[model samples]
Target: MTSIIVFYLLYLLSLCLGLACVVCVCVWSGHWRGGFAWDGSALEFNWHPVLMVTGLVVVYGVGAVVYRIPLTWGQNKLPWKLLHAALMLIALILSIVGLCAVFDYHNINKISNVYSLHSWIGITATAVFAMQWVCGAAGFLLPCSPVTLRKVLKPVHVWLGGIILLLSIAACISGINEKLFFALKGNATGTQPYSSLPPEAVLGNTLGVLIVAFGLVVLKILSNHEWQRPDSRPEGLAYTPLLQEENE
Candidate 1:
């Protein structure tokens, strides 16, 4: 009972933090960064941060916890699998769009691409996420795959999901700091530097903190063995449709 209560509390906290992260990024970009546009301007670049948080952080985080939710334990696994896949697909599409927006903006401004640590980590995380989704679908969703293979890959998939989320958070934090530095360096003569705790600086730092909190809560939920979906198989293995079908 205590575990269940703790799980729900953590879940609620994660949701709030995730939402705050998204809203913070949007407000920071839209209000302070001159709003959004698609005309290959700085405005267009703002969409990159907004979409990345929405997709990589919020959407992907939700998908990761779906399988572990106690409320969904008695339900059909196939539907949850499909829902997870759909969420991942959405995340992938949004990430691709975010990358395009930044790349296009850089090209238009004659700026170099993928030169920063933030860019390198972000790109790698996205690529790995895309591959994870594809391979997961093939291994778990496909009816013809060997059951042994699915069981072997399950742990790897879960491990990589957590790693990708951490990587995304790191990339976002670095990106936030990098942007603040740029803002401080480009400020007018009388403008306050980042060290002065400017509004934008405060908001960006808050977003980074919120994202990290959200990721930690999510990882907590996922790692708690007590919160995982109940396994009814004789050996206490997770419930999988293919395995059941083959056994029957």
Candidate 2:
């Protein structure tokens, strides 16, 4: 019960943070700037934060915890695995679209691309996630794969997933800081810089905190062995010994 409570609480917190991130980006680009667009305008840049939050933060979070839901624990694992992969694929597609938008905007404006620490880490994380998904599908989802192979790869998959999540969060933080610094730097025409705690700065900083909190809560939930889903196979199964030994 305590695990369930904590899970739901963190789930709610993630939802709130997701909403806050959307609202912050919308306010910053729509209200404060001019509005959003896809035609290489400043508004086109707004899609970056919005889609990154949706894909990396929201959808990825759901994918990470899908197997932990109690309702899914009693069901056949294949369906759950398919659902997990589908959610991750959707997240990856969203992330690709977000990346395209940013790159297009940069190209249109003649700005250099992939030049920042945030871009470097973000691209690497995306590439690693794509590779992980492909390897997972080939190893675990294929019927021809041996059970031993699956068991051996399971731990690797879980750890890589967790690491990818952390990388995504780190990229997000650095991206936010980069954007905020750029905004502050461009405010030289004004009497007061963004150091004065403008509404946009406050919203950006809050979004960063919420993102970090969401990642930490997710890590905590994932690390709790008590909340892990149990294997659905019955006793006396051929793979039972392998799983038991691995668990031990």
Using TM-score, give the best candidate's number: 1
Model 1's alpha-carbon lDDT is 0.86
Clashes of each: 0, 0
User: What is the TM-score of candidate 1?
Assistant: 0.93
Against the true structure, what is each candidate's TM-score?
A: 0.93, 0.87
Tens digits of per-residue lDDT for model 1 on 1-248? 88988998998898889889988999999988889999999999999999898898889998888777778776667677778889989988998899999999999999999999999999999999999998898888777767688888989999999999999998889988998888766366454688888888899999999999999999999998899777656553353543343221
Kindly give the stretch of ten consecutive residues in candidate 2 with the minimal lDDT sum: 239-248
Q: What is the lDDT of residue 61 in candidate 2?
A: 73
Model 2: per-residue lDDT, tens digit, 1-248? 87788777876776676666667766766776567789988788888877787787667877888778765666656667778899999988988888989999999999999999999989988899899888888776666667787778889999998998899899888998888777665455552456777777887788788778778777777887877887656543323321233221
Clashing pairs in 2: none
